[model samples]
Structures are given as structure tokens and as C-alpha cells.
Target: MTPLSHIRNFSIVAHIDHGKSTLADRLIQSTNTVAERDMKEQLLDSMDIERERGITIKANTVRIDYTAKDGQAYVLNLIDTPGHVDFAYEVSRSMRAVEGSLLVVDSTQGVEAQTLANVYQAIDADHEIVPVFNKIDLPASDIDRVAEQVEDVIGIDASGAIAVSAKTGEGIVETLEAIVTELPAPKGDPDAPLKAMLVDSWYDPYLGVVVLVRIMDGVLRKGDQIKMMQTGARYGVDRIGVFRPQMQNIDALGPGEIGFITASIKQVRDTRVGDTITHEKKGTDTPLPGFKPAQPVVFCGLFPVDSAEFEDLRDAIDKLALNDASFSFEMETSAALGFGFRCGFLGLLHLEVIRDRIEREYDIELITTAPSVIYHVYLKDGTQMDLHNPADMPDPSTVDHIEEPRIKATILVPDEYLGDVLKLCQDRRGIQLDLTYAGSRAMVVYDLPLNEVVFDFYDRLKSVTKGYASFDYQLEGYREDNLVKMSVLVNEEPVDALSMMVHRDRAEMRGRAMCEKLKELIPRHMFKIPIQAAIGGKVIARETLSALRKDVTAKCYGGDATRKKKLLEKQKAGKKKMRQFGKVDIPQEAFISALKMDG
Candidate 1:
């Protein structure tokens, strides 16, 4: 067994597309964990979606055996974490499992919004942060400028920061040496009761649920009875292993070691992330601290394009949810959408990832409604309720006040595009808090409603800044707002899934735009259809879909004017009857298109 003092647990934290996965590959290769012939690009990222998007959605852990120049062998566990703000919870979980972090920044891009956000997280976790400037091999790399930016933005000492080109394997050995000497060693008692933290888990068809855990104290062995402190679920460990780039079975894992524990667990829900695991008979007096379930912030309705495939969609969601604990779904029915699931996600990217996985992995087409953020409804009766869907909102009169979730957003962009970006934020009801400059880049902070940014804010930000702005945000609690729920009506009938909560001042304008967009999407029917947007009993905006024309007059080409008039009257009568009794067959695409509004 490796001595506790010889083990160093650390993770790599950075912004998206900052070569985090590449750096991880360099570290693995430099240690000779995998043979050169067997090594592949982004070997730590196992998911096809991750590789295709060039982003890490999941946190991956690997143990490396390295022989330092001090003539001592060290067990180095590297937990590679996602860089996107959507997976901030995963980063926090990984931080809890490690003692230090390698804060990576691109030499050309300097410190971005996500990089600052993650550095703050590492600081909050009390982890030792080692600043690393990456991609120095690039032509635009200014190592000194980036090091100064890191110090100015992150308030860290960059004099000792390592500069390395992960792509060329330069300065990799020095990085490893820094990890051994600079980072603190993990400290835990081997004789104490078994206490481990489940940072992540996944469902394995062959081995059941594989739980990735960091052993804090005592030892965990195969066949030992383990119980989850949060759920109180008990199971005998079926296997114990560590990731040497891949799963390698081990007899036991002790304190300071990061490994997997399989206990024939059938469901991923049972093996909760951020939960504590302890020996059934030798459990600790209290479970580990800082355990909380992930809460989804963005929500949308997902329906199979063909209603007949609802069951297939349900099964697919369950299977996917087994691996993604941050994703949540429940059964929901809509007048326009028939039957579907109301799914919740961490953020927009998380929502997109889940949607893509359902379509690609399950081979099922889906119709996703507009995404919304959870709102808090306060009633005059001194009661509070959480509103996940706009359709579930109570009458405006009954609501004394409504509070919407807001976020403290930080954006980093080139100084030249600062005005345009600031204008975009202000248009979205964002209140500018501060603006500072880090060299040629400007860091802008704002307090904006979460719902405002959930849809097309990022895309628009990219457009305005010419893809140079980087954004990061965190929940800043809910605040009271002049909010009202706007409903869409087709032929005088309301569609629940199309309802949206908007500021009262912009409700009429938004409603008008929604109706206009819907008119373009809904196909012409035999009867005239009037699409109206209303709040409560008052209609604010309306659009009409003209009835399809027929060749009723063509048949009477040789007849007199009286015959033509008779045919026209009959056609009008038929259309009237159809309007009274016939239901508007709004196509699935119409609903999706109507709610696809970015502004």
C-alpha cells in the first residue's frame, strides 16, 4: 500500500476550450500510465458527445504512479473536471475530493469568466491552487502578459506559476514535480471508521452501478457492507477498483485514494452523488459535511415528435438520467403537445446535452418547448410556492408578488466590443454592477434575471462580441419582479406549454411577436384560425391564419353570376360550421417555432 504522505490528490480546473483535456492527456502520457501506441486524444474523455463537442461534461478521475526526482514513488490522482458553467456542481464535487487544483489559463486568451469562477470555487473549498499558463507554443502566446492578468484577475501569486505547452509535452515533468513539492499531502487516519464521499456515479449494464468515491478514512474492501448516509440504503460491495486510465480491480482502497465501488446497485438514484458512504457495521458518528443534492435551474417540456413514441422517450430519459443526476424529468400532458415529460436541467448547455443525447443515443426525435427558470410565487395568504412551469402559475390576482431567480453574471470581452455587449445586457433587464479592465479585455458584471439568459443570451453575446466574450454566472437568489404569465390561444383555446412569464411592461410586445411568429409556423387549415395572446381574461395581441382557398368557383366557370354566388355562400357556411366544431390541428413544429423567440 502507498503511504498516505506519498499520495497527492488534485484536479484540473479551467474555462471551456482551454486545452484542459489535452493537458490531462499530457500528464497521463508523461507518467507513462498508458503506452504511447495506445494513447489517444482526450483519452480521459470517454463519452462520444464530449469528444464531438470538444467539451467535458463529466468529471473523470485517474490514478497515476509517478517516480519523482526525489527518488520517491508517489500516487497521484488527477480528477479532470468539466469547464462549463453548467457543470459547476460537478466541479464542486471534484474539488471536495481533492486537496489541490491546477488552475489552467490559456496564454493567448488570458483569464476568462469561467476561469475566474472556477478559481473562486477552488478558493472556497480551501484547495491549494497552482496557476498554470497553457498553450505557450501558440504564435499569439504572451506568457508574461497572461501571468500578470492571472495575478490581476485572480489575485494569485503568478511568479511561481508554471508555463507549459500541453500540446508539445513541454514543462510536463516540471508540473509533476511541482505537484509533489507545492501541494499538500492528503491527511486521514487509516484506523478511523470507514467514511467516503461519492463524488460521481454511473449505471453499468454489466457491473450494475459503479460509484466513484474518495475514501476519507479507514479502508473499503470488496464484499464489505456499505450504507449510504443520506438514503440509508445498504449493499455489500461487489467490487473495488481504481482507475489506472481504466478500471483495475484492487483488493482494497484506503484513505486518500480515489476509486470506484460496485455493490450490485441497480439504480443510479440510490447511489447519490455528494452523499457519504460508510461501513454498515463500523459507521462514523456523523456523516461527512457539505452534502447537498444538485438542483436544476432551467426547465423545458420534451415530447416525442410522434405521440405514439412517448413510452420509448420515457424509457430513454430514465436510462439517461441514470448517468446524469443533474437532469430531472416528470410526466406532463399538454393540450397542444399531447403527452410528454417536463424536464429540468442545470443550465442551457445541460439542457442541450440532454436533448442531444436523447436524440442520438435513443434514436428518437423530440419537440422541446421554450426553456424557463423556476419562479417563486408569494400569495397574499402569506404562503410561498415554487413555479416550475408557467401553466402551473396561479391567477395574477391571487399572487401578491412573484420572484424570479437572478444571477450574478460576469463577462470578459475585448474592449472594443464592450459597448455593444453592455447594450445587450441592459436590453435584457440586466443592471450593470461593475466594469474593470484586465489589459485589453474588459470584465463586466451584472445582476440579470436567470430566465433572460436561459434562451439566446449566450448566442447573442457571441454575435455582438464576435465570439470573443466569455460568460459565467451563479444564482444570486430570487428577487421580486413585476412578472405576469402570458398565454397563447389558438382559435380561442389556450395552449399550456406555450405560456410564459414575462415582465408586465414587455408582455404585450412579446405577445404580439409570439403571435406573428406562430402565424408563420401554423399551416393554413379549412377554417380561419385566430391566434391570440392573452393575460388572464384580457387579450393583448392577435394574428389570423387565413382559410385555405378551394376551386369552388372553378366548377362554375360557364355558369351565370347567380350560380357563382350560391357556391360562395355554401363555402362560407361550411367554413363557419367547421370553425364552431372543428379543433385547430396545430402541428408539433408550430408549437416549437412559436416559442423559439430569442428576444
Candidate 2:
């Protein structure tokens, strides 16, 4: 067995686009963790959607053998964590598996809100932090200023700050040395009862459900009968595997070892993250640290472009849920959307990542409603269900009272946009809680309804402020408020898919902006469509665009019968590309393109 003294465990934490994955790739390559020819960029992010989006959605661990400057062989267990705020809960869970963290900060962008949040999380987890300022080779990078900021914010000594450009392989060796020196070896009871925490798990078609666990105490081996602490279910372990970035099947795993275990457990719910695994015979009271399953912060309805793919969508979601525990779905059918699921997610990016993966990996096409947040409403009998769409909401008369989800939002923006941001927040029913100054930027906190800010608020803020603002939020639960159910109309027909309940204060302005975007996004079909925003059955705003009457006129045949057949065929093909929403058939790109609207 490999001794725990030679092991070093750490994770890379950083903001998005701050070279976290890039540094991980270089580390993996330099230490020969993977072969040179087989080394793919951002190799730790093995999922297709992760690579396409250039983000780490899941925390992955890989072990590498590196020879230190003192000529000692070291076993480095490197964990690559998600950079976005959506996966903060997952980040905290993985932090328990490591003794140290490499806080990767971008020299050009300095410290973002996410960076600060993650640094605090690592510190709170009692992990040693090695600050690394990345992107030093960029022309705009100011390493010295960022170093000072890191020192000031993290309260760490500045002498060990390693500046590197992961893109150019600069200062990588020093970073490696720092890992060996700063990170401590795992300290735990290796001969105690078997105890481990399931950090991540996924279903493999060839091997069944495989769980990735970090052993905290005692030893685990193949053919041992183990019990899940939470479920009390038993399984005889088939094989224990370790990751060298790729799953490496092994005979056993010991304390401080991070690896995978495959049992005959076929059901998805049996293998839960944070569930403790223990030897059934020993029955030691030493249980693994458990973390609460992630609570979803966003919800939306998803359907296919064609109704025939409903089952396909369900299969895709089922397969995705094997790896992503944050995505929750309930069987639902929309009057306009047909059979689909009301899916819940941790945040906006989590929703998008699931959607992208389902489409890309499963090769299924889908159409999704605008993302919504959960709302608490009391019924006549006092029963409550969190409503994701206004259509599902009980009538105001039936609702004895209503409360909307509120979030504690922290935003950091340049001083120039403070006035505009304040106005925008006020329009969204945001009440300022506190404010502070960080250099030229103002750190403003607001308590706002979740429904108000979910629609185009982030995009508008970024646009109005020239992308200089950083926003982070946490759920503060529900609060009593006066809200109105608003429905969107196309040609005087109510669209159940686009309805939402929002604060009454800013409905008019937001309605107008939303209708304008809808007008631009909803395609011109066989007939003209009128986009209208209505509150309580009263039209508040309206917009319209002319129909595409001449779309098929050019293809019409004048005299030849064969030409007429060809024209009809071309028209049918064109119609196949359009998505039918009531009387209007919209193009496939309209839904996505509309999301990028500046307004």
C-alpha cells in the first residue's frame, strides 16, 4: 500500500475565465498524469458541454506522481472545482476532501465576487490556501496590484504568491513546488472502521453505478460488504477504482485515497453524495461528514420541438441526473407545451448546462420556457405548492395570501453605474440593505424578489454598465409582498408558456421591454402576430410586426406539374424547420437569439 506521507491533496478555486482549467491542464501534462499525445485541453472537464462552455461544472480529482526539487516522489491529488456561484454548494462539499486549495486569481480582472466567496469558503473549511495570480502574460495583467489585493483580502503573506500565465506555461514549476511545500499530507485513522464520503457518482453502462469517494478512515477493499449510512442498504463492492483523471480499477482503497467503487447498485437513488460508506461487520460509529443535497434556486418547463420526442427528453434527463444531482424534475404537461417536465436547477447556468448537455450528448432537440424562480402561495385550504409559472398559480381569489421568493443580492459595480443600478433595482422591488466601497467600485446589497430579477436583469445590468458589474446572490426565503400575475399575448391569445407573476411596481416598463424583445424574436409566420402584455386581463402594452406573406410566393410553380411538386416539397421542408407555437411557427434560433437581446 502507498503511504499517506507521500500524498498531497488540493483544489483549484477561481472565477470564470480566470485560467483555472488551463493551469489544471498544464499541471496534468507537466507531471505526466496523462500522455502527451492524448493530453486534451481542459482534460479534467471530461463532459462535452463543459469543454464547449469553457467552465468546470463538476469537481474532478486526479492523482499525479511528481518528483520534487528535493528528489522526493510525491502523490498529488488535484481537484478541479467549478468557478461559478451556482456550484458553490458542490465546492464546499469537495473542500472537505482536501487539505489545501490553490486560489487562482486573474491578474487582469483582479479579484471577482466569486473569487472572494470561494476564498472564504476554503478558509471556513479549514484548508490551507496557496494564492496564485494567473494570466501574468496578458498585456493588461497587473500582477503586483492583484498580488496586493490578494494579500489584503485573503490575509495571506505575499512572499509565496506565484504569478503565472497558464496559457504560456510560466512559473508552473514554482507553483508545483509550492504545492509540495504548502499542502499537508492527510491526517486520519487508517486502521479504524471503514468510513468514506461519496463526493460524486455517475452511472456507467459497462460497469453500472460508480461512486467517487474520498476515504477518511480505515481501509476499503473489493468484495467487502458495506452499508450506506443514510439508506441502510447493503452492497458487496465489486471493484474499487482510483482516478489518474481516468478511472483506474484497483483491488482496494485506503485512508486519504480518492477513488471510485462499483457495486451492483443499479438504482440511482441508492448512491447519494455525502452518504457515508462503512463496513457492515465493524459497525463503528465513525460516520462521514454529510452535506445537504443542493436546493434548486431556479425552475423552468422544458419540451421538445416535436411532441414525438417527449420520451426522448425524459430519457435524456434521466441519464443527466445520473451525474448531476442538482437537477430536479417533475412530470408536467403544459396546455401549450404538451408533455414535459418542470425542471428545477441550482441557478441559471445550471439550467443552461443541463439543457446543453441533454441536447448535445443525447442528440435530442428541445424548446424551453423562460427560467423562473419558485414562489410560495397559500391556497384556500392552507396547502402550498411552489409555483414556477403563473399558469400553475391558483387564482388570486383562491389564494388567501401570497409570498414571493427573496434573494440577498451582492453586486460590485463601478461608481459610474451606481445611479442606474439603483434605479434598476428599485424598479424590480429591490430594497437596499447596505453599501460599501471597494476602491472605485461600490459594493451594494439588496433584498429583492427572485421573480423580478430572473428576467433580463443580469443582461441589462451588464449591458448598461459595459460588463463591469459582478453579481452574487443567496436565497433568503419567501417574504410577503403585493404581486400581480402577468400574461403575455400573441394576437390576443394568451400564451401559458410566457406568463409570470411579478411585482406590480415595475410591470409596465418591464412588460414593454419584454414585449419588444418577443416581437423581435417571434418569427413572422403565415399571419401577422401582435405581442401584448396583459395584467389582470387588461392589456398594458402592445407591439406588432407584419407577417411573412411572401415567403413561399417565389417557389410557386406557374405551369409545369413537376415544378409544382418540387415547390411544395421545398415549402414543406421550410415548414419543418419552424417550431409551432399556437398559430405562429417560429424558427429554431429565435428562442436562443432572443436571450442575447441588449434590452
Candidate 3:
């Protein structure tokens, strides 16, 4: 076991594509934690999707043994955290378990919005941050400019910041020395009662629940009976191990050490992330302050195309929920689309990832409803409730007003795309809060409705800015707005899944878009099918999908004009009767396609 003074615990935090994972890989390689032949790029990223998307979804940890110039061997525990805003919860949990962070700044990009967002989180956790300039091998890399920007924008000293190329391993030795010398060692008392913070947990098919923890005080043995402070559950540890990029069993873990343990646990839900684990017999009186429960900002229903596969979808979601605490779900039944689950996600990307995982992993075809934001609905009777699904909305008469969630969005884009970015925000009814410049790039902050931003706002932002803009946002609470429930009716029957809450100002345009999209997506019926977008009882937009007409008068063309008129009259009455009783055969694809209201 390593001494407390020789152990350094830190996490790598940066903006997307700022070389966080690559830096971790280079560090591991330099220390020979994994053999040169056994090593691979992004060794920390375990998921295939993560490697393909070039993003870290889960915060991964590894231990490295390094010998410094002073002839002292050091143990480094590094947590590679996700840079995206949606996975901020994962980053925060990882931060709490570590004492310091390596704040990687892209030399060419200077300081982006997500970089600032992540750095603030590290600051909030009271982490001692070591500034590092990454991607220095590129021609555009400017270590001096990035250092100045760090001092100017991040308000941190960068004179001693290490400039390194994580890809080429140019400064890996310097980074390791900085980790051992500059970063503070974790403080813990070995004699105190066992108190380990559960940094993360996931389900393994063979091992059941594999829990990663940081030992704050005392020692944890393989056979110790551990109690989870948050869940009040106890289990006997069967094995204890540390990841040198691969699980290696160890006898015990002491203070300031990060490792994994597998007790005879059943599921990941039982092992709450950030929970304090102590010995059942002799435990600490105080529990560590755990993380705030991750709140899902967006809600949507996911139904299986084949109703028989609903159980498979449920099982897949259950397995996914083990690794992901932020994603949530509940059983729901849609009138149009049978049994399904209503899942909540952090944002649009988070939703898409989960959806893709379920479809790809479990081989289940899914039909996702239009995503909706939680609304605070106040009634005239002085009652209030959260509105998740617009289909469940009460009558507008009893409702006093509806409040929608708002977000404080920050977008960093080049000067060329600044005008388009600003115009996009204005179009979404966003209120400009502040606008400033970070070198050539313009940083624009706006208070925008969360509902507006969730539905294709990111896609639109990327398209308009030509993929040069980086954006981050936080919930700014809720406020009353001119919002109403907009429902789509096909042949006078309301499709519950197609209902949404919209701002009264833009409800007409939104409804019109929906109506037009449905007209194209829904197949033409034998009878004239009327697709109408309505706000309450008032129809805002209408589209008529003309029926496939058969020549009823063609047979009577040679007969008298009166006979032809009679034939037409008979056909008209028959069409009216059929329209009244006809059921619109809306294919499953239509519900999924119409929800893509980029119209």
C-alpha cells in the first residue's frame, strides 16, 4: 500500500474535444500502468458508442504508479470526466471524490463555454486546479494566448501552466511531476472509522453491482460488512480491487486510495452514488454530504413498435438505469401507441443517446413521442401540480396560468457566426442577458425558455453557426408564460401523443408546422382526412389530405345529366358518412416522423 503523502487524486476537466481522454491515456502510458502493446487510444472509455462519438459519457478512473526525480514513488488516481453539460452530474460526483483537477484548455480554441462551466464546478468543489494547455502539436496552438485567456476569463494564474501535446506525449513527464509536486495530497486519518464515498456504481453481468469508492478514513477489507448510509443497505464485500485500466484484486484499501469493491449486491439502484459507506459494526456518526439528486429537465414517452417487445424495452431501460442515475422512467400507456415508458433525460443529446442505446443494445424498435418540458400549472382553486405530459393537462378554465422552465444559455462562437447566433436566440424569444468578447470569439449569454431550446435548438444553432459554436446552459427556475396546450386532431379525433404545450405567441406557427408535417407523413385515407392543429377548441391550422377519388360519375357519363348529378350526390353523401366513421390508419412511422417538427 502507498503512503498518504505519496497519493494524488485528481480529475481531468475540459471542454468537448479538448484532449481530456487523450491526456489520461498518455499519462497511463507514460507510467506503464498498462503494457505498451496492451494500450489503446481512449483506454478509459469502455463503451463503443463513446469511442465512436468521440465523447466521454461515463466518468472513468484508473490508478498509475510513477517514480519522480526525487526517487520517491507516487500513486495517482485519475478520474476522466465527461465534458458535455448533460453529463455534468457525473463530473461533479467525480470532482467530490478527488482533491484537485487538471484544467485542460485547448490552445487553439482558448476558453470555450463548457470549459468555463466545468472549471466553475471544480472551483465549487474547492479543487486545486492545475492549468494545462493541450493540443500544442497543432499549428494553431498558442500556449501564450491560452495562458492569457485563462488569467483573463478563468481568473486563474497560468504563468506556470504546463503546455503539452497529449496526442504526441510531448509533456507527459512534466504533467506527472506537476501531479506529484503541485497538486496537494488527499488528507485522511487512517485510525478513524471507515467512511468511503461511493463515487460511482454499475451493474456487471457476472459480478452484479461493481462499486467504485474513495476511502476517506480507516481501511476497508474484502470481507468487511459495509453499510450504505444513503440507502441503509448492508452487504459483505467479496472482493476489492483497483483499476490499472483493468481490474486487479487487492487485499485492502486505506485512506486516500480509490478502488472498486464488489459485495454480494443485487442491483445498481441499491448502491447510491456519493453515498457514504461505513462498517456496519463501527461506523461514523456523520454521513458525507451527497450530491443533489439529478433532476431530469426533459420528459418524453418511448413506446415499442411491436407491443410484444415492451417487456424487452423495460428490461433494457432497467439495465441502463443501473449505470445512469440521471435517466429516469415510469410505465405509461398511450391511447394511440399502447404500453410504453415515459423517460426523463437531462437534455436532447442525453435523450438521443439513451434511445439509441436501447434500440442498438436490446434490438427493440422504439417510437419516441415529442419531448416536453415540465410546467408548473397553477389552478384557480389555489392548487398546483407539475405538468409532464400535455395529454394529461386539465381544462384551461380551472387553470390560472402556466409557468415554463427557463435556462441561462451561454454560447461561444466566432465573430462571423455571432449575428446568426444572436438572431437564432431572438427568434426563440430569448432575453439577452450579456454579450462579451473572448479574443475573436463572441460569448453571448441569453435567458431562453428551456422548451424552446430542447426541440432542435442545438441542431439549429449548429447549422446556423456552421458547427463553430459551443453552448452550455443551466436552469434558471420557472416563470409564468403565455403557454397553452396545442393538440393535433386527425379526422376530429385528438392524438394524445401529438399534443404539446406551446407559447401563445408562437402557438400558431408551431401548430401550422405540425399540421403540415402530419399532412405529409400521414398516408392519404379513402375518405377526406382533415388534420387540424388546435389550441383548446379553437383550430389554429388545418391541412386537408384529399382522398383517393374513384370516378363515380365516369360510369354515368353517357346517361342523362340528371343521372350524373344524382350519382355525384350519392358519392358525396357516401364520402361524408365514411369520413365520420373512418379510422385514420396512421402508421407507426408517422408518429415518430411527425415529432421531428423541424418544419
Candidate 4:
């Protein structure tokens, strides 16, 4: 094992598209952790979606052996973190496993919303931060300007900041040396009681469940019985290993080291993230300070395209959840969608990632409802209820008031677009908190209702700013609002999955827009179908889809007047009968498409 003084634990944090994964690849390659022939772009991004999108969804941990300029061998454990706000929980877990972070800021983009958010988290954790200006190979790179922004916005020293281009392998050696000299070595006693925090875990077909952990104190090895402090579940360790780009079996993992362990556990829930793992026989009296379990902020229902695939969808979610602890689901039945699951996600990106994964990995096409935020409903009798699905909300008469989740949103945009950006926020019922200038960009902070931004705020923000704005937000707790539950009825039958909790002022406009979108999506039948949006028993908006007509007079081309009249009467009777018995068959796509409307 490497000596304590020669060990360095650090993570790379930055905004999306700031070259985090690329930097990770360059570091791994520089350390010779993986052979040159085996190298790939974005090596740390294991998922195909992550590589295609150029973003890290899950945090990846790797150990590297580096020889500093002093001719001394050093061991560096680098944790690669996701750059999006949706994966902030993953970032927090990664931060806990490391003692320092390399805060990468794009020379062209400067400090973005996510960049500040991540830096604040690292600061709160009291981790050493080494600011680095990345992508200097670009012609538009402004190193000095961004370095100044770092000092001005993040309140960090800019003199020591290193400039590197991960894509071109520029200044990488210097960056590595800086990490060794600047970051503090982790401090822990190897002889102490066992207290390893399980930061990440996944289910393996051959190994059952594989967990990635950081040893806070004591040693872990194969054949030892381990206990999860949170769940109080124990399992015999089958294998202990470290990630040297790939898993390699190790005899033991000591304190201040990061590694993986596989126990004969079948379920992913059995070995959860943020759970403390300890040696059964020599366990510590207290568990390490691990984060609380991640709570989902956004929710939507997922249904298979085919009703018979309901069971397949359930099993797929179970297996997928084993790999993603942030995703959650429960059995949910929709009158329009049939049998499905109500799924919860950390944010919009998380929802999209899981949806994409299900379609790609499971080979199942699905219909997803509009995403909704959780709400708190207070009853007249002083009762409180948490509502995840809008259809589950009690009658307005029984409720004293309703509270909806709010977020402290931050937007970083060029100063030229400040007026338009502020206007957009104001239109969304946002309350401006503060505004500050960071070089050429304006950082605007606001308190906005979560639901208002979940659907299309990002898209609109980009549209209004011409794709120059970056946004990040965190839940700011719940606040009382004039909220009402709106429902969509097709042919006078309510669709539970189409229900939504909307602000009272925007209810009519949103309801009308939803009805119009649904009218276009729902296929016309023999009878006219009425699609209405309602609040309680009152209809707020309505749209009628005319019936599909058939030509009954086509065969009477040369018939007499009397004969033509008789045929017309017969056709009328047939049409009336069909209208009385025909049922509107709403397709799954209609429900999905209708819910996608943004008012």
C-alpha cells in the first residue's frame, strides 16, 4: 500500500460541456492507468447516453499511480463527477469520497451556474479546490478573463490557477504536479474500527451486487462479514477490489482508500448509496457521516406501449433501479394508460436519462406522462398530506390551503440578454433575489415555483437567450400558493394520468392549451368526441373533435330522385346507430403527446 503522505484524493468538477470527462481521460492516460491501445474518448463515461450527450450522469472512481517531479511515487484516487444539476446528489457523494477538487472552468464560457453551485458545495464540505481553466486550445479561449472571474465570483485566488486543454494534452503534467503539491493528504487511522461509506452501488449479473466505497477508517478484505449500518443488513464479502480503470482483485483496502466490494446480495436496495458499511466482527460503534437518502423532486407515470408489456416494464425498472439509486417507482394504474409505474426522478435531465435508458436497454417503447412536482395539501381539519400525483389530491373543499415546492434558481447569461432573461423569469412568477456581474456574464438569482420550471423553462430560457444562458436550481422548501388540480376528460371520462396541479391564474390558459393539443392528437371516431379540461366539477376549457365522415351517396350516381332520398334516409339511420354504440379508442401516443404541451 502507498504511504499516507504519498496519497492524494481528489475529484474533477465543472459545468456541462466544460470537458470534465475528457480531462479524466487525459489524467488516466498520463498515469498509464489504462494502456494506450485501450483508451477511448470520455473513458470515464460508461453509459452510451453520457458519451453521446457529452455529460457525466454517474460519478466514476479510479486510482492512479503517478511519479511527481520530486522523483517520488504517489497514489492518486480521482473521482469523476457529473456536471449537471440533476446529478448534484451524485456530485455530493463524490465530494465526500475525496479531500479536494479540480474546479474546471471553460475559458470561453467562464463561470456558469453549475460551476458556482459545485464550487459552493466543495466549499461547504471544506475541500481544497484547485481552479483550472480548461479548453485553452480553442481560439476564443480567454484564460486571464476566466481566471479573474474565478477570483471575483468564486472568491478564490487566481494566481495559482493552472491552464490546461484536456483535448490537446496541454499543461496536463503541470496540472498533475499541482494536484500532488496542493491537495492535502487524507488523514485517518488504519487501526481504527471499520467505517466505510458506500457512495455508489450496481447489480452485476455474475457478482450479484457490486458496491463502490470509501474507507474512512479500518481495513476491508474478502471473506469478511460486512454490515450496512442504515439497513442493519449483513452479508459475507465475496470479493474486494479497486478500479484501476478496470476492476482488479486486491487483498485488502485500508483507511483513506477508495475501492469496491461485492457481497452475495441479490437486491440493489439491500446495498444502498449513503449507507455505511462496517466489518461485522470489528464494526465501529458509530457510522460515518453519510448523506441522507436522495429524495425525488420530479415525478411522472411510465406506461408500456403495449398493455401486455406491463410486467416487462416493471422488471426492467427493478433492474435499472439497482444501478440508479436516485430513481424510484411504484405501481400506478391510469384509466387512459392502463397499468404502469409512477416514477420519480431528481430533475428533468434525470427523467430523460432514465426514459432513454429504459427504451434503449430494455428494448421497450414507453409512454411517459407530463412530469409533476410534489405538493403539500392542508385540510380544513388541520390535516396535512403530501401529493405526488395530481389525481390523488383531495377535493379543494376539504383543503384549507395548498403548498408547492419552490427552488432557488440561478441563471448565468451574457449581459446583453439580461433584460430578456429577467422578463422570462417574471413571466414565470419568479421573485428576483439578487443580480451580480461576473465578468461579461450576469448571475441572476430568483425564487420560482418548481412546477413552473420543470416543463419548458430551460428550453424557453435558451430560446430567449439564443442558447447563451445556463441555469441551475435547488429546492428552497415549500410555500403556500394559489394552486388547483386540473384534469383532462375525453368523451366525458377523466384521465388520471393527465391531471396536473396548476396555478389558479394560469389554469384557464393551460387548460385550453392542453385541450387543443389533445384534440389534435386524439383520432376522430364515428361520433364527435368532446375533450375538456376541468377544475373540480367545473369545465374551464373544451374542444370538440368532429366525427370522421363516410360518403354514402357515392353508389347512387345515376339513381332517381326517390331512390336517392331513400338511400340518404337509410344512411342517416346507420350513422345514428354507429354514433350510439361507437367508443373512442384513444391511442397511447395521444396521451403522451397531449401532456407534452407547454402553455
Report the number of the highest-lDDT candidate. 3
lDDT of 1 at 438: 91
Which pairs of residues collide in model 2? none
- Model 4 clash pairs are none
**What does the lDDT come to for candidate 1?**
0.92
Residue lDDT tens for model 4, 1-599:
66678999999999989988899999999888999999999898889998888889889999999999999999899999998899999998889888999999999889989999999989888899999999999999998888888889889998999999999899899999999999999888888888898989888899988899988888887898989998999898889999998999998888789999988898888887888888888689787776877889999999998999988999899989888877889999877778999999998899999999999999999998889988989999998998989989997889999999999999999999999999999989999999988877899999999998988899899988999999999888999999999998888888887889888999999999999888888888866888999999999999999977677677777757888788778867876787667677778778767766553
- Tell me the TM-score of model 4: 0.96
List ranges where model 4 is wrong by over 4 Å. Answer: 557-573
Model 4: lDDT of residue 94: 86
Q: Which ranges in model 2 have alpha carbons more than 4 Å from their true place?
A: 512-532, 542-599
Rank the models by lDDT, top first: 3, 1, 4, 2
Worst 10 residues of 1 by lDDT: 590-599
Of 2 and 4, the candidate ahead on lDDT is 4
lDDT of 2 by residue, 1-599 (tens): 56888888899998878888999999988898899989888899888778888889888888888999999998888889998888998788889888999999989988777887888889988998888989888899987777877776557776678988899899999999999998889876888888888888878898888888888889999999999988999999999887888778889888888888888888566788898999999866867668778998878888898899998998888888877777889888876678998899988778878888888888888878867887788888879877776787776778777888899988888899999888888867789999987667788899988876776778777877899888888888888887778888777777777777767776787678778888877867754577898987688889986656444546564777787667667766654454244366556566555444243
lDDT score at residue 226, model 4, on the 0-100 scale: 86
True lDDT of residue 129, candidate 2 = 87
Q: What TM-score number comes out for model 3?
A: 0.96
